[model samples]
Target chain A: MNTPNSLLIRRSRRSSNLSFVALGLVAVGLVMMPYVVYQSVTSSMVMLFVLVIIASMWNLLAGFGGLVSIGQQAYIGIGAYTVIVMADLGVHPLIGVFFGALTSAMLALPTSWLAFRLRGDYFAVGTWVIAEVYRLVMIKFQFVGGADGKSLVGLSGLDPVMRSALTYWFALGIAILTVLGCFWLLRSRIGLALTAIRDDEVSARAGGIDATRIKRIVYLVSAAGCGLAGGILVVDALRVQPDAIFSVSWSAYMIFIVIIGGIGYLEGPLIGALVFFAMQQFLAEMGTWYLMLLGVLAICAAAWFPKGLWGAFSQKTGFRLFPVGYHVAQRFDTPVDSRAPLFRN
Target chain B: MQILDALAQGILLGGLYTLFAVGLSIMFGVMRIVNLAHGDFAILAAFLAILLVGETSFPVWLVVAITVPAFAAIGYFLQRTLFQQSLNSGPLSTLLVTFGMSIVIQNALLEAFSANPQRLDVGQLATASFPVGPIAIPYIGVLGLMLAILCIVAIELFLRRTATGRMTRAVSDDPDTARLTGANSRHIYGLATGIAFGAVAIAGLLLAARSSVEPTAGSMRLIFAFEAVVIGGLGSLWGTLVGGLSLGVVQTLVAHFDPSSSILAGHLLFLLVLAFRPQGLIPARSL
Candidate 1:
């Protein structure tokens, strides 16, 4: 749309169109990767995708929605448990992934009621405690393997290579969907409301935004995204352990990735996940030192580079893979009057 | 008889839990900073005591006495530098930086001490207890309770009577306004953090005396302390006491019937409190 000022207003930039095509090409390439890439490489890709999904979900909640929950492992565990338990009951693990998202979103409803009570820092701890509650509760349920955990059954009938390939494919598909989901969500009217609420909740509320409701929606979406990651995680690992699935380390990893990559940017998690994957590949043997390195890196990122690596890069290059903001640019076709006044002045 | 015995034990446990929580309370109350590393620092203090005990021929209590003041100094230094920077960045930065610190400390301890659980040797104090009819109260439990009461009283008195305490409260209430009134918020925050660190170190030492602690033990303590703070109410010291005691009682009572469900019971109680009374059981009227 062009205003009287001869400027066009639009959401998508020229780069976004290019990014869309690039994203498509990458998706197609990744879809064919399992067929050509080594099985071990495929497994690693699955983990990378899982990290990307969770990190993005966390970024959505914390960065955009301003809800910094350190307990998202609650949904991850719930997702894994749901998928594995469904496998026990004669459902295919592939189809169970969607169910995982559904179940997580369902669970997040009750969770938000309890968790949303606490402000800022307290909310983070509240979510974590809630996750702990879920973990402890899951341990008591003997039907789904209880404290000892259970292996993913029903997959034994399929060929090992086929199962791995299927898992890899699902991971890739979901990772793509999660990224696209975030991009689409952020470019919508809800996204506008989210930005308003994040910048100033009181002003946003005064401006007629349903701040609580919008935040709840974002929280549910994030929970669903994490749940999808967890389902794929179970399928990839072929087991479900309450402690392992519900581990706070997942949140740590998510927080670390978001902080280092860029907390509020859509492209941040993708970059952070890649860096994390490379670090993991090289430093897997370092054990606790590797974790310490990650911790130190995260602290440095939060302290020195609050905008994160991508945020800095974007600021310098003025590049964006996904642009969620509306921009105004002067129309080139009608720009002929340098002598005319630019404004009513 | 069993219930009464459990009740006594729970109360003693409550004292230790309060000790774990008060430092966290002060940090939040004063600086509005949630130290995610609170539990890890406690474990770090316990480990420091262990190292001291290993190096010297001194008793564990003496080692703890030495370690507490040292930890206070470290806390003051850390807050003045690292925490102050994060606080300037915003709450997200504070959470991320502290969370990162937590992971770093946990991993460092793991690398230094391995995964093996270590405990402080209290000698006869480990077994010494006084009989109250059917209930036997351990000497260490009584000591912990006494020390907890003393610490709380001391802190309360310090906040009420001392000039530094008044400045700390002013900063807690409004850092900018306090600064306008000639108080240095950063210095006050450092002092608050120092006291918190000292208190938590004592909590850690008592925990080591009570049970074996490993590198990974910090997160559990973090949760317990956090739960106590939330249940009792934020920014209220006595509320923390109440929260800790109730949490202790609930866990013990549940464990008496089903051993595995004790921790779960505490979490449930916290959630119930959150659901019904989000302001906490005894909400803070003033910092």
Candidate 2:
């Protein structure tokens, strides 16, 4: 006979020794990447970092927050523009990037008030409209070079090699920090609320959670993260253009990466970004064919693998590199013998 | 007189916008699916009309006659084959799949037609205009307005008087109940999409006659269509006309002040509408 007190309150494994080892290995590799790779390769790496950051933030917004926004490019464009304006005003490019992110976050506060008025699919299109408005408004600002755009004048004095190296490191740092921040946030109490909200908003509200408040918080965070990526993007390009930065293709690419990787999982964006970068490297010369292929791939993925690549893979294998949810386990009274285990292996 | 000219032109432009929006409204009202690729399909129809006219030396009217029904068939088949699968998956999946379709259509058009813009030759109608009191309106504009009204009336009659249309309404209201009542909801959805596509096809031909179109043109068309739909409210057919006219007038009025601010003004109005009257000018009850 078992007593009520004998029951165990087991939780999911947060990290394994192997996960730590992998993390250490990745950190070491990234730290040494500039020395090992060419300048061109470093630029590609910076791009990959930006994709990962954008995809991760998108995943956070849509997958967890249940806000399927299609207008995230607004923040990306705004962030880029902010950085450019700051640089033009004689601020250091590095410092400008930070201010750009701040500006985006501040802007998001008001944008959310307008955007949150709509629900579900309406919200998606509303965001896109807002982004278009942002782009159009940016085009009218001739001081920032308007529709023609302008190059960053602030970074002209830095050595080419040193600038590239610094940008790469900054990108790498931002990418890792963004992922880590997401993981930490998801592991907290708020994460549990988000999970509940994602599964069922009405039920989550019924369960005493402030669904609106939490969603607003998530929206703001997502904006800040995307803004950071946007800031980094302008620095890497050393040029800012409304047409280029505000392009819907940015949103499309983010969607592709998040969906391919696994929308709801932390590890999904990382894998998706890598896969996308690899595909772009090989198939980019195919031009329209590459884009068409991406579209086909997304359609197929949506139909068959709604859980995404990593999502399906994790479900089958029962493996999680960054576990944020609880896993139940059995507890035994006696210490584990050689023949028997206390928890399922 | 100047303001009157802008208003008259805006009203005529509104007719074109109504054409763009009505199809979107019907699809949303009946299917509860926002076809992200709606504008791309319109662009595709325009290109198809251009190709048909170019290859066969058919008149623009003849080309429209050929393409509209063909578009309906394409829409029917697409809903049956591709969109049907995603319908039950949830709105997010439908959105993603349709977005993917948009990308595919846009890229395919780019590949097939290159980046060059193409315009349909309307002969004398392109430049011809007649004075109405103090305002001058182009012949094409009047034709576009008349066609828009005709299409809207036809679609309204079809929905109200037809059995299939009622079934579509039923399916949209409650799919399971409609299914229980022996209505093939899937088939009804297909028909609804087909009708919507037919409207889009005509709009596409009209659009080509009005201006040049390229592969990427669909996106702006989509934004305009979406704005009209939102401004009109979700399920009101007549409100779409009002919405479209409002959008057109706002753009023209803004352009009057500064030509560069034309598109921006429309977008700003959309945002204002969204903020103040999210239910739109004429709100509809639940579908």
Candidate 3:
């Protein structure tokens, strides 16, 4: 059932305006949480939220930009190690996260130049190989625990309460910024070019969309997100290990969260994470069965709910929670402006 | 002498590599899902064989005999129910589906078999060896090599000679056209998975004979098989055999020189091959 373009356009028009009230309420709720509640967030648990942010970026890249990569952990490891290195030089870990993100973005530049040459699964395999190369190189270096990894608490002079609060705030800010950044980007011209490339790269190129360049931007942004997340992850734990940080499972976890939640929408990871967290709590003792059940759920969801939990929700409810872009009606047929589908071209 | 020794040993390991890659290659060649759960299936077979050992005082060979058919039946059902409808939706969807299956199998195996590692008591075959010029080669190694050769040949003949095999070839080659030609792809995938899992059961026997088994072992085996398939270029069955041998030889040679470098050497070989021959040493016509 192909939807009429005009209806899609009308729908898109309605979702453009931001619901600032909703955004404010959410932001206020987060800020209102006390230090104890903030401290209650463990590094691994908090980092899962960061993973959702990174996955959203990847979803944009692969889902909307059509750049599938299995090696985003390369940037993640790079980001994490960069933080450790910077901190070793006496920089505050919080500030080190920004630098780490920048470093990862810089690394993605050369990688994108090479990876951009490949297409489909070749691109994915190239990324994996590149990640391995990065891992090998990291192993040769001695300062950051090499393959064995190192503790990030070398500068443990900072107060514990302060550390947790700052780390929590940093993670939250990054998460918000990442989500907001994606929302803004998805509405712009580059976002249009990316969406075009995703649908049909050849035709998109023929239409003078610089597919390679847009893909490069998406890649760099995704790297920054993963890198920052990785940095935060290391800082929260005050540890850095190449194998632990760079393991393919890191990216696999991102994929799982994204797939289960909803890859194409911002709300997917949030909903999926809540569900995942609950599942983890209940089935923690089952060990391997827990992983297996999640795997089965992921497979079943992917096969049946390709759009994911949020995607399915949107289709059923026809409601937009975190809508980006919009179909603004020039005629002003509806009062108070309404929400519409964002992907309408 | 050491290099020669390594090469001979690599060839022997290649026998297991053959067992690993052949099943994966066959599934990929036919269904194209990469069967991420392929290695887990091997582990499952090993567990089943161990259970059979407990129930009856049957020879390991007898256990292999019983489990192969049983696993094939399971594979057939899994394909028909889960994989067939989802086959054509591009690689990521399929990859995700298979990955999920892998997790499921691993967890299921853990629950059923517990986390403790088990070893197959192959009596003296593993410890016993045949004398060669200045070197001793184990009988199990030779037996593995022969088994690989026999199975490869049998699969080749089956594909080349049989009607069902021809259908498998046709569907694998041009699925849409095959559909137009009245080939039922789901049934073919079921048959293909059945055969792949069936062979995987035998591979499990050899694996249990060679080393201990546990839940986590499948992913490692999967990586080796995956490397072989990629290195071979999904070119053909023979290519996987060559790929497996080359990988085994690389690992053995490195291990002969230094133990830590063994894993590194195999991974390095993959990187080198991928850089130079991304198409693989030999590629199947369609992969």
Sorted on TM-score, best first, the list reads 1, 2, 3
**Residues B149-232 of candidate 3: C-alpha lDDT, one tens digit per residue:** 787898888888998888889998988899898899889889888888887877877888787899768877877776776677
lDDT of 2 at A301: 80
1 or 2, greater by lDDT:
1
Docking class of 2: medium
lDDT of 3 at A251: 63
lDDT of 1 by residue, A1-345 (tens): 333546555666678789889989988999999888899999889999999999999999999999999999999999998898888888998888889999999999999999999999989998999999999999899888889888988778888898889889889989999998999999887998999988898999999999999999999999999999999999999898888999999999999889889999999999999998899999989999999999999998897789898999999987788988766644755654555544320
User: What are the C-alpha RMSDs, in order, of all predicted structures?
Assistant: 3.1, 3.1, 4.2
Give the lowest summed-lDDT range of ten residues in model 2 chain B: B86-95
lDDT of 3 by residue, A222-308 (tens): 998888888888888788778778877766676787788887676777777667777776886878767877887888887777788
Alpha-carbon deviation at B81 in model 3, angstroms: 0.9
> Tens digit of lDDT per residue, candidate 2, span A17-69?
47857887998899799999899999889999999999999999999998988
Cα lDDT tens digits for candidate 1, B214-274 = 9988888988999999999998999999999899989998999999999999999999999
- Top TM-score prediction, candidate number: 1
| iRMS per model in Å | 0.6, 0.9, 2.8
Q: Which candidate is the best by lDDT?
A: 1
Clashes of 1: 0
